[model samples]
Target: MRLIAFGESFVAGVGDPDHLGWVGRALAGRRAVTLYNLGVRGATSTKLASLWRREAEARLSDEEPCRIVFSFGVNDTWHAAGEARVTPAQSLLNARAMLTEAASLCPVLLVGPPPIPDAGRQARIEALNENFKLLCARLQVPFIDVFRPLAADGLWVCEAAAWDGAHPGAAGYQRMADLIAAHPLWRAFTLAE
Candidate 1:
């Protein structure tokens, strides 16, 4: 299996103490699968989507099947301080575009962003995430709601699992990976391989 992941710093494993990103953590023991981490720190969904082709070309071959995992939403909500920032509608559009592009290549697993504490910001993030989920369903692609599970457990806000109350620590990443690995989509891929 050739898996390519694209997202922001969280997907880049910014706060992981072990220094191995989720790709490294997730594909650790697979014998025949090749995992590629295309996560870029501070990459918005729009930017990541734009860069996807360039990055994917280096790892993807014409004959090999591929799977794309997209993680975003937090940056879209958190970085909207100026007029140029993406609105909720535009955020959804960006996600849709990403899904559209990914579908053309292979199966896509859309992983929604983890929850952030600020209620005001979270409202936008939640809207974006919900839209992403709906879009995934519409596209018949797999969707992973990391926000619901992580937020429900209060792991995202816990101090021990984060450095600045946002990004996940190693334990948090482990928990996140566990959640991801257990998802039916991930299990299906793992088992199929």
Candidate 2:
């Protein structure tokens, strides 16, 4: 299988000195799969939704089945400019529509944003994540909720774990990779192949 992942810097593996995002880690040593990281920094869901088709078109191939991973949202929350500001619900709706459009061509997975350091920011992130999760269920697409699970242990506050409060470091990305690997959807693809 060939997976094309698209999103913002979080997906780009911005802070990772090794430069391998979750996509690289997920596909490590797997000859059966090739993963593409199309993550760009300073991107919003609107920008990603608007440009995904053009981006994915270039990465897709007929030789193998393709999977698209949608990971975005943190920028939206951070871009709100303040801690208490709530991201508009329409952002999630628009993101869902974008993912749905992509799913029309191939299997799509919705990967919610990671936890943030600010409690207020975390609240908005969680709400957006819940919205994304619900939409994924409605669309019958796979959903990965990384927010609540990561927030449970106050994992985002660790210094070496995730710098800049939003992006995760190598260890944090590894944890996320583990989560995706264990998911039923990931297992189905990895094992059944």
Candidate 3:
């Protein structure tokens, strides 16, 4: 299996002390497969939509089972000049196009954006999460809602707040990895041979 994890800093494991981020922890001990972390700091869904194909194609193989995992939106929710980096509507459109193409290529899973310390930004992140959920449902893709759970988690909140107010520490990343590990969809996908 070859897995390509696409998104922004969160997917890149920015604030974690060990630097293994959630993606690394989640794939730990799974030496049978090749994993590529294509996450970029401060990247938006628009960037992901534009770059994922080229990135994934470089690592994908015909004899291997390919999979894609997407987690973004925190950057999209970021505001500049009084407007979001990527509007909710536009975010949905980008996700739709990306997921549609990714699904056609291989199995795909989406992890909704995690929460930030800012209430205003968190609100935008929440809205994006809801939209992502709906889009994933309509597309029949597996969607994991990480925002609500991590939003209320003390470790995630405190660690992220103490750090960059966005990315969390090792404990928080572990929590995220645990969540993904326990998700039924993730289990089903990994169980496939």
Number of the top lDDT candidate: 3
Mind giving the per-residue lDDT tens digits that candidate 2 earns over 17-67? 779877677777788877788898988888887788998898888888888
List model 1 lDDT by residue over 1-193, tens digit each: 7888898888788878787655567666776677777778877777886898778768877776677788987877865445425667878888888888778877778888887777776777778889988988998888888888887887665833347756767777777887887778887755545
- For model 2, the superposed segments whose C-alpha errors exceed 4 Å read 79-86, 160-162, 189-193
After best superposition, candidate 3 residue 42: deviation in angstroms?
Answer: 0.5
Clashing pairs for predicted structure model 1, backbone only: none
Better of 2 and 3 by TM-score: 3
Scored by TM-score, the top model is: 3
Alpha-carbon RMSD to native, per candidate: 2.1, 2.4, 1.2
**Could you estimate the TM-score for every candidate?**
0.89, 0.89, 0.97
Error (Å) of candidate 2 at residue 48 is: 0.2
lDDT of 2 at 80: 39
TM-score of 1: 0.89
Model 1 regions more than 4 Å off = 79-84, 160-162, 190-193
RMSD of 2: 2.4
lDDT of model 2 at residue 121?
A: 70
Reference-based lDDT, each prediction: 0.77, 0.77, 0.89
Q: After superposition, how far is residue 131 of candidate 3 from its true place, in Å?
A: 0.9
CA shift at 115, candidate 2, in angstroms? 0.2
